[model samples]
Target: MNGRISLRGLRAKGHHGVYDFERADGQDFVVDVVLELDLSRAAVSDDVADTVHYGELATALVGVLTGEPVNLIETLADRLLTVCLADERVETAEVTVHKPQAPIPHDFADVAVTLRRSRL
Candidate 1:
């Protein structure tokens, strides 16, 4: 009955960096989320109510991503994790925030922060 829902490459524009220009010219942040929960109820009842509404989840995440300006991606990741674990049905959640346009001197493909949390 255990199940997993994964959402990847959720892109949103936000001003979340240390530099002033970064705040002025917002950049896109990509988030990937994985949620673990019991699917038995949803599977048997065929009700969206029994399972996490991923579409609504995406909207909530984007709201956080674009909501406030933070100095670190770590803070952003933590905020996203809070949103991920909001539902009681979600036993565990993992979030990865990717900053592809990070201001790095050397050439880099990406910079990301990944955090995982579970209910106590």
Candidate 2:
């Protein structure tokens, strides 16, 4: 429960936005994920089976990012949390969804939404 797994800058193209052109042309989305769990077993055993496989998690999330066309990043973050929490090893999962090319009237660096889920 004291260990952490952080996956950052996971970029993928997605067609999710309020504007019609955004959904039509698509844009890059950045994701950051953090998993809280106990890594003592994997630390001592040096086996992947003792812990969650982040690669598989990333692949699954990428599939979701490329598959659906959600209207908001908040919804997407919730969806990503669902995937992150699917791993039994993860006691708590945090998902951050970033939209860099949002339709803002003024110049801005990025927009993002973060959500956290915990297993009881």
- lDDT (CA) per prediction: 0.96, 0.91
Total residue pair clashes for candidate 1: 0
What would the TM-score be for candidate 1 when compared with the true structure? 0.97
Cα lDDT, model 2, residue 72: 90
lDDT of 1 by residue, 1-120 (tens): 999999999999999999999999999999999999999999999999999999999999999999989999999999999999999999999999999999899999889999999996
Predicted structure 2, TM vs. truth: 0.95
* Clash pairs for candidate 1: none
Deviating ranges (above 4 Å) for candidate 2: none
Candidate with the greatest lDDT versus the true structure: 1
- Assess the local accuracy of residue 113 in candidate 1 as a C-alpha lDDT between 0 and 100: 95
List where candidate 1 sits over 4 angstroms from the true fold. Answer: none
For residue 22, give model 1's deviation from the true position in Å.
Answer: 0.9
lDDT score of residue 58 within candidate 2: 88
